[model samples]
Target: MPLSINSIAPDFKAHTTEGMIQFHDWLGDSWCVLFSHPKDFTPVCTTEIGSVAKVKDEFDRRGVKLIGLSVDPVAEHMRWAGDILAATGQSPNFPMIGDPDLRIAKLFGMLPEDATGDSASRTAMDNATARTLFIIGPDKKIKLTVSYPMTTGRNFDEVLRVIDSLQLTARHQLATPANWISGEDVVIVPSVSDETARQRFPGGWESPVPYLRLVGMPS
Candidate 1:
């Protein structure tokens, strides 16, 4: 079955550019962003990889770890680093998992269980469904999942914005509003009653409607 929000992220052992890793152990006590590409050396994904490298420090600032996956061997991923650097001037500074056998891809439900063959024999189209991103919390539960079509490049800035919102809302009983970014007013989740909200937001809140109470971003 496909993973959903709140599902415990599946754990696995794999060969990454950084060496062998047990997924859960590598992710101990931190948020994580695990994104995948259809293949190594692909155009759009190369730029995406470089983009992540450029923003890695921001992710680190937020206590989030970044990792990537591609449907190729680690050697190919290493070789592609040169291309990524040439194209975007930034090479990946994080581990990149090599899914040559599609083991991790199928385990994460990115590809069908019946999918077969090593990445060496498959074309990019054959692994198109592998383009997905997962955001996991410190508890190792998936907080979000996004799959992109092969032709589109992902907006990683929005990914950072979401991480900010996720971290904030997780710490407080609030829900971000549409197009919300950090430091903006947030809505009190409906489950938080007025009485509870009062105690939490003792300074006060703005209620344009009965249930749509808006309050400043909590520190």
Candidate 2:
């Protein structure tokens, strides 16, 4: 089965633009946003990566590390970084894994277990499923995942917003509502009864319905 939310992000040692790294050791208790592109030097993927570099500090401020992947080798990845920088004015210095043998792709279930070929032999369509996003938490479990089609571009700003929600909820017994943003009211978890909610959020909450209690973000 494909990895699910709350599932442990399978660990592996792989080659990255920064150097070789064991996945979990590199993560090192920090939250991680690991996304993939079908191939390097593709137009859509290039733009998305450039955008991430521009917002790199926003990710750092939240204690989240951003990494990327493409089926190309690390050398090709190094070459592509130059084009990304020239086009976007910022280099995505984050470590991008080179899955030339497709081990990392298969390990993450982005390809069939029996899939074959090195980066040179594969077309972007052959590895199209490699386009995915995994938000892993400090516990090394996946918090969120998203996969994009070859034609569509990803909205990384939305990714940041969701990460904020995930981090806030991890630290409090709260959940975000539709269209929620930081500093907005969040709903008390259904598992936390009104009585318990009172103790944790002593300031009281707005209950539009008996089952729906909304309150400001807790300190």
Off by over 4 Å in 2: none
TM-scores, one per candidate: 0.98, 0.97
- Whole-model lDDT, model 2: 0.92
Residue 125 alpha-carbon offset, candidate 2, angstroms = 1.2
Model 1 vs. true fold: TM: 0.98
lDDT of 1 by residue, 92-173 (tens): 8999999999999998999999998889899999999999999999999999999999999999999999999999989988
State how far residue 84 of model 1 sits from its true place (Å): 0.3
| Superposed model 1: Cα runs more than 4 Å off | none
lDDT of 1 at 101: 96
Error of 2 at 136 (Å): 0.1
